[model samples]
Target: MGERLVADLIVERLQAWGVQRIFGYSGDGINTVLGALRRSGTPRFVQARHEENAAFMAVGHAKYTGEVGVVLSTQGPGAVHLLNGLYDAKLDSVPVVAIIGQQSRTVLGSAYMQEVDLLNLTRDVASSFRQQVNSPEQLPLVLDRAFKAALADRAPAVVIIPHDIQQAPAPELEQEHGVLTTAPVWSPPTLVPAPADLERAAALINDGGKVALLVGQGARGARGQVRELAEKIGAGITTSLMGKPYVDESHPLAAGVMGHLGTSASGFVLGECDTLVIIGSNDPWTEFYPPPGAARAVQIDIDAAAIGNRYPVEAAVTGDAAATLEALLPLLEPRPESAWRTSVEEAVQRWHRLAAERAATPARPVNPELAVRELSDRLPSNAQVAVDVGSIVYWYARQLRLPEGVPAHLSSTLASMGCSIPYGLAAKLADPARPVVALTGDGAMQMAGLSELITVSRLWPRWTDPRFVVLVLHNNELAEVTWEQREMEGDPRFDQSQALPDFSFARYAELLGLQGILVDDPAKIGAAWNAALDADRPVLIEVLADPDVPLLPPFPAGEEKGGTMMDALRKEGRDTQHARDLLETYLRQEEGLNRGL
Candidate 1:
């Protein structure tokens, strides 16, 4: 059979898979594919200034649209630029297909211009990587396989199209292959609980006078099942930072998140619980601190490695959260209605009341916490929220409550800064009809590709019209968690030097043809938020915050010293002191709040 050009064949396959937009950067090597796109005129191309931003935008699109987001780049540096974004997509489980235009097949190892080993570089970030195509005939099969791998693994996949092959042409497109249009089948790894594991876990639940249930990102599709398990087990439920969307906060058993910025109730319940059942949560850094001398522990997870990775588990059930919970339901003998459930519920309510009381204070500058609460309350039920990394993330994680069934996206694994703006744009692109809000810190937003706002404006004119809102927490500094490290070391330099100049972020937004509002007063935050959301175009609400405010203390395990600054601080004898002071202040405030003073 005669064959179509590789570029044409790829575009045809993408169209068949329902791809509507290709977010990418143009280059000489990929011009062949671009020409093919121009001629075939199927999937529309949305050009980005940088390949990394293009990949990020595609990730946003995929998350919101539930379609395979496509990003194109030239080989070598261009392909390398996409690595971070690709890794983000992979870790976050966003389905994306990246196509790189490689040097001609003739120069495979000749060090031709823009030639680099893309396949090797992309292997770790991509679920599957295909080398450059040498023949037009192989195009259809390769494209088909790429899509399947991307969707099946729930990750990003890369396909390399050689420049020479993309230019070669022979025949018209063939009939659509059945495999090309079908969704990949996903079967959760089958794991049945051991008879002993179930019995032991059930016994722990029955005997414990107080229990707590903690959920994580792995519980995405199993929220209802988790809630049912919590109710049946008579346990107070809390979530890891990444698991906030799993259960509605309105649930009586919900005790907010349990971590660094976790509520006072979380600490109380976590400390007091006789048993802790960790469900699909692998976060040991902050979320899984076992209480001192607790009754026992049960862990359920799909990944066997995570079963006992953190705390010592008396019972480890290696199975999917929802499926395992369903199975365990029948095995659990009903317990008598006891005071344990009521006690936890009362504690949670008390904490909620205290939080409400604290928020009622009308401070001069708007309290950041109150702003977060107001935004959480005002946004539409289905509004999509994309949060940047910083102290602001802590606030959102602890306070913001999304309506049930609404999806929220964040960079949980990498926890990279500057992800909010791109994520928001991507969310808007993914579902143009759904209102999208970006909660970003000023420092982080400055580091992001501001030019992408132009792309977003061009793509969705309404975003520039005033209805879109980007809430900037203008703390005027990096506000890194490491300040405590500096303080503990008795270094006076830690506090103010880290701050940034008070530039006009709102003005910058205005220059980009979006409405801009500067919020300095606590009482005016709600009005500003409402006005921004009411606008017909995109709006930037730059909120000025005190940079000196400390982040909440780390959990019992202490702050994670992962990066360079943290390592440096550790060497200077500054680490432990900073952690101690931060923890002390946090505990004091928490105690005061709990006392109803």
Candidate 2:
């Protein structure tokens, strides 16, 4: 071990820290490090088709394993490509580390080929920690701090190693900073709200007859406690997009999803609540929460930084989600079930009936919602779903019937496309025993993830079971953005630029040594889904849906009962009668509602 190379030391340290895989493409600047990684041969490197996909894969790995996932790329363009995926981790507060290979210091400051300031390029997204190792002696301290900051801040970090420095002999390693690696299951120091803050929160819950629990991604570990708090207070539970799979939607108090992707039932509960309990989440979107001063609010979170940042806070109890709930549980009185809870329950039940009708009654171009619902029905109880942002989320956010405790991942904070596939791939890599599904639109698949299908081709033969399923809702348009352009701008011309060239995803899959299936007929969707789940390989099911089918959120954009198909069409300048005709046909087929047209 005497006089080891700096690159070799880094690989050894990462291995000691329990890193099993690295995702990236190797180039001249990074060759030395790759060689060192190969020499150690313990942590395997996953070669992705694109640097962006490599970044997304790292994020996926971090989220599923609850550890800092590592990604690497050579300098300049390779570094730039990591930005989008790195931003996802930063925005979502997921721990990830990106290592970039730099040109030799001998070429410093000449604007050399593929040589840009690594720290400067990555600073915005990797603000937690960004460092360049100038000397071989600087390697240990910089690497350790990068890992430390990534975990402690729950954000992405970056480290740059010049080509010349990486091959230099490592100095006597300094172990004085205690264990260099972060905890596998990192837990911040336990924080309890002051006695006065607790009393204030307790008073609000007791005084407000109708309480509503709004869960966020931050409130992940406290699902049971959140449920108890809701039930005890006779409140309904609603979740932000990231919190959608945290609580069982089947719970009587469940208001289903809230915020931009909110269900009508959840929206009603949020609007009607007298007091709101914000748990583990900053609740980033203003649209998701009640208007400021609309209701008294009690906020509980692990990071004090988020308290009162998004919404006005009457009681800010800073602590772990579950722990804070436990502390407050004794201080509050359980309110008996009120009309509020009954109303929420009634609304949810109505929604279920409506949803079932819609799923059964179908129309031409197929109801995307129905397709998703049917797919949801066939997926195993423990299936891990990675949902992309956009039209696909319209189905996944409202329709995908996720069982409680089933882990789900998404790029909610960044709200980016092309994340779902790599997210699923990362999840599958972490836990090969479970089935992982990536739900995306045709635009998203073509954007970033399509190339990574080749990555799957390279890795899938060794996989023991269903490595993953990429469910593409093939409408051949950026449906989510297209809807926004129409509704927000009142612009009906959703020109060619908004549309995608139709693709044969099944045929594309075949060329990659993977299973491919096309499901245009609704009758065969279930069978195709079953075959994919049963297959030992990764499968892509391209579901041909309609471009005209309006993809709407569960609730209205604002405070209205009009996320309905009619409303979407009306805004797009379709005549009232025509809108009604489309709606009636859809309702009749999906919901069996033929009462009027």
Across 1-597, the per-residue lDDT of candidate 2 in tens digits comes to: 446788998897788668999989888889889989887886889888888889999999998888889998988899989999999999989999899999999997999999888878887998889999888777776777888889889999999999999899866745565424223233457776788888999998898867888888877888888888888878888888888877878888887777665576777778778799988776566766777777899998888889888888899898888888888999989765788778778767766765666566555556677778877678788778888877888778778888777888889889888998888888888877888888888998899878888877887766667558888889887877766655555455355678788789989999888999998888888888888889888999989976555544444353232233445466554344543464545444423321211
Record all residue pairs in model 2 with backbone atoms less than 3 Å apart, i.e. clashing: 357-590, 357-591, 358-590, 361-589, 361-590, 362-589
Query: Top model by lDDT, which number?
Result: 2
- Candidate 2 overall Cα lDDT vs. reference? 0.79
- Any runs in candidate 1 off by more than 4 Å, and if so which? 1-3, 65-67, 127-130, 170-204, 284-288, 291-295, 302-306, 314-320, 335-337, 357-364, 462-466, 481-484, 487-497, 554-587, 594-597
Q: In order, how many clashes per candidate?
A: 14, 6
TM-score of each: 0.85, 0.92
Scored by Cα lDDT, where does model 1 land?
0.73
lDDT of each: 0.73, 0.79
What TM-score quantifies how close candidate 2 is to the native fold? Answer: 0.92
